[model samples]
Target: MRIARLGPRGAEVPVVLHDDRAHDLRGIAPDVDGAFLGGGGLDRVRDALAAGDLPELEGADALRIGAPIARPGAVYCIGMNYAAHAAESGSAPPERLVMFMKSPNTVQGPDDDVEIPRGSVKTDWEVELGVVIGTRTSYLRSPEDAWAHIAGYVVADDLSERDWQLAESGGQWSKGKSAPGFCPTGPWLVTPDEIDARAVRLRSRVNGDPRQDSSTADLVFGIDRILYELSQVLVLDPGDLVLTGTPEGVALSGRFPYLAAGDVVELEIDGLGRQRHRFVAHEDAPEVAGA
Candidate 1:
């Protein structure tokens, strides 16, 4: 089943997407968040659908669509998981998994305006397949168990600023990765049964120019291994998001220019969904509560 949140940011209500329409799911749970998923909410949603209990959400299409899920507990990312991406970055394929974190506050709706950080140059885009965890996972026994822990998937743009990531932050990528509104995710979340995370084609475009075009098949370390490997080191909780990494074509590859104010970024993964974000100068954004 596809799930989403609709309304203004911070006040989004849960809904289920059906045939290009949204059906209210707030009666089933407050939101399609970690707590709801951890407490057997998906099962409840399935049951409700079977019973035809959900109400069609009126005016849903007119309301703003927020991120499919609320701010997750942690936003983990895999670095250079795609072999082609590693090659473009002037790095050899690593023998083991390389991971990083984005501040949870960076998470925003798919259509939200992305802020180019103050005094920034080299801000970039990464279109990635995002895995949303459904269960508490720690010390998982085998790679085979990985799929069971995933709740669903979403489209994620792992926005970055090269300056903070590589040159000035003491080699820590998260410094550049965690700016507010850097992570724009989801028009909706698609369940595992509906999408193949391993073989889907994911791509990105800046303004109107094509920039990235690749499949998850190029990943050096696929989902199963990444999950198994990470479980050994850290506990992944429900509603935690894992950005599986981007492909070769990105601003970081030096083939394209860094994103500028008023530039539009569009990204999509086959069967999962798509996202479009407009880049805005830092000074142009209004001050909000979280800022």
Candidate 2:
């Protein structure tokens, strides 16, 4: 089943899609949060669908989609997990997993407008497979344990600003990655059973020109290995998001220009779904104290 959240940003409601129509699930579960996924909500949704107990969401196509899962506990990212991406960035295949975080506030609807930070150049796009955790996971004994802990997957655009990430803000990548609307994900959440999480084709286009095109099969560190490694260091809670890195051909490779205001970025992962976001400049955002 393809699960989605629809309506305005803060007031979105969860629904499940079937026969190309969305069926409201608010009556059976709350927004797609930790409590919902951790407490067997998907099972309940499937049972209700089997019983014809759900109401079709009227005009769902016209409704604005929020991120398929509500704000997760956190959004963890794998850096350069794809061999080609690492090579393109002039680095060797990582001896150990490289990781980072995007502030939870960066979460935005799949089609929302991304803002170009003030005084910025080198804003870029990364299309990656996003793994949504369904249960508490820690120190998993082996790679085989990964599938049991995953709830589903989503398409994620991991936007970044190179200057702040590599030069200005010391060497921390998240400094340039955590901008608002940087992580636009999900037109839908596809359950694990629906697709092969390890070998999907993921691609990205900027303003109708293709930038990245590759398969998850090229990942240097596959999903299961990533999970096995990460779980040893941190507790991945229910509803947490993990961006499994991106394949080659990002603007960072010096093969294309960086994203500018008015650019439209389209990202897709086969079987998961597609996402499109327009880029805009934030010229007058108010400053916060010490920001």
Q: Write the per-residue lDDT of candidate 1 for residues 165-253, one digit (tens) a residue.
A: 99998978899999889899898889998888889999898887888899998898899898999999999999999999899889889
Q: Which pairs, if any, clash in model 2? A: none
lDDT of 2 by residue, 1-291 (tens): 899999976888799999988999999987998899999999999999999999998999999888999888899999988888899999998989999999877888898877888888889999989999999999999999988999999999888998988888777789999987888989889998899978888888988988888999988888998888999999999999999998899888999999888889999989988899888878633321110
Q: Whose lDDT is greatest here?
A: 1
Candidate 1 lDDT: 0.89
Top model number, TM-score: 1
Q: Which ten residues in a row have the lowest lDDT in candidate 2?
A: 282-291
Which residue pairs show backbone clashes in model 1? none
Error of 2 at 172 (Å): 2.0
| Candidate 2 error regions (>4 Å) | 284-291
225 Cα displacement, candidate 2 (Å): 0.8
